[model samples]
Target: MKVIKNIIFVAIVFLISIGLLVVGNGYDMYKDAISKIPLTEKVETIKEKENYTKIEEVPEIYIKAVISVEDHRFYKHNGIDIIAIGRATINDIKAMSFVEGGSTITQQLSKNIYFTQEKKITRKIAEVFMSLEIEKNYNKDEILELYLNTSYFGEGCYTVKEASRKYFGKEPKKMTDYEAIMLAGIPNAPSVYSLTKNPELAKQRQKQVINKMIEYKYLTQSEADKILEQ
Candidate 1:
């Protein structure tokens, strides 16, 4: 609960602060997400052509944990989840700030691969369209694979394979459920919840992910508790 409150506060402050720092042309940025996203931008991006990890190569627990927390309705929805957006709207009104992002996994993948992370409604709208386009072109597993292969985990690791090795010195298939949950939660806000920079925050987010897993029926209460115990 405190973690959520803190996130809301931070998001409010960050959004207000970025109002002035909203750099780059919105038009160009919109074009970016709609078109091709560069592979290595000194930051990170999902490559379209090379070294993609197959869905079978990643652990099943990782996929379930990510979908459970990030977007339970990912397989059900076309791309955007209106229910999530409505829930976020309610929370935004109650908080009097736009802290909650009701974006689905595909929408996030859209943002990561297509557009810049500018906090603007217009960019979000563009992301929605691009997300739908991606859904139309790719299957659920394909989208998940692209998302997993492309996401940026903090500590300078852009790809999940790199993140698993760099953070735990293990391959993706070798990661435990707890490790998978922790990694699953990182892409939500990489810098703030980075395990190296803020282990507590990262752990708290992991707990949230576990809670979501339970809520979504991906794991039972005992299973979740056991994972947390580890």
Candidate 2:
């Protein structure tokens, strides 16, 4: 019994050590990611003034679209999408590979901010913890805004606002129905659905977004059809 107790104590200590390391590394990674953002320049300059602010305010439509496509239960979940994680795990085990990831937007943001592009269990664990921290610290809108602004959407664009300008020559808030659908599609796989590279695929993705909007009652079938027609 003494030996068993010793073994359990050692295991607990090892787990605590691992958790601390993961969190420490995650903080470093988050700081690095924030530093690399171009908007950091704007943020710093603004900070010099009395009324400094962050420009990446979360838009209602943006949040709705993301939740509709990525994780419908985002508001309900703590930080992780258990169903997606389970599915990803099952697929990974079946294929003996790590190609699939069932990360929530928060998790993805956490991973992007604090973890390498590596597909490993250690990185994923860190991502989960960081996501939980993010959720705890920020409101949903703030978290969503940060995720949108920092996430890579291919075509060398890091922010939805930049992507909106590049793709539709408008800001996200002013995006037309077609433009919003197109922008929404980019997060799935930007290069493949990029209007410049694959116009047809981009159109298909836009249609998919419109369909989702329709199903979510954000738009009617007629509205979706009209947008598609345009």
Candidate 3:
């Protein structure tokens, strides 16, 4: 019993030391990320309603579709979703890999504008800080608009308007709910799920988006099915 206690004590101390190291390095990484924020060129179009910009005129259905699919609690949480973070943490531990992420739209925008796509613990920590900063500075609508305007949809698609024109050759407001949901699904993995690159995967992801909308009570089964069918 005494030896077991000693071993446990050593293990606890070791674990604490590792955690401290991670947090310490992570804080330094956060500072570096903050430093990069000013250097990151802002997408000016996202800041204001431009006469010719589709983002400024994006429809309610498009916003709802994105919120439903990307972050169901976009309006509920602060910068981060604790429940989603916890869920992702458990799954990552179980998988022994960083398989799940609980990034919100603001966090994704933070990466899009301020950070690179380097998958690292430090990058993830930096994203958390950047997301908080974004939430402090911008409203939910602004964040969603920026994300829609700046996010990639593969096949050289750089914005929601671009994606719409690529797929349907129409403006965003004129797109049907089915089209909106399909575009909403592309940003998850643009390479694998772009409407033109891997259309089958894109369609599958669109179904998931509609299902999420139904689960969130934004749409009924009949509504989801109707959108899916068309």
Best by TM-score: 3
TM-score per prediction, in order, is 0.79, 0.72, 0.89
| Range of the 10 consecutive residues with the lowest summed lDDT in candidate 1 | 38-47
Kindly list the per-residue Cα lDDT of model 3 for residues 1-230, writing each as its tens digit: 99999999999999999877877776677678667555234646454434224455677778888999888899987779889889989999999998988888877888887778887777777788878877887788767777887788887776777778889999888889889888888888998886766889989999888888888988999888788788
What would the per-residue lDDT of candidate 2 be over residues 35-69, giving only the tens digit for each residue? 66533453344245422223444346556667777
Give the number of colliding residue pairs in candidate 1: 1
- Candidate 3 wrongly placed segments (more than 4 Å): 39-56
Residue by residue across 96-150, what tens digits does model 1's lDDT show? 8888999999888878776677767768777777777778777898788888876
Model 2 regions lying over 4 Å from their true place: 1-59, 215-217
- Candidate whose lDDT is highest: 1
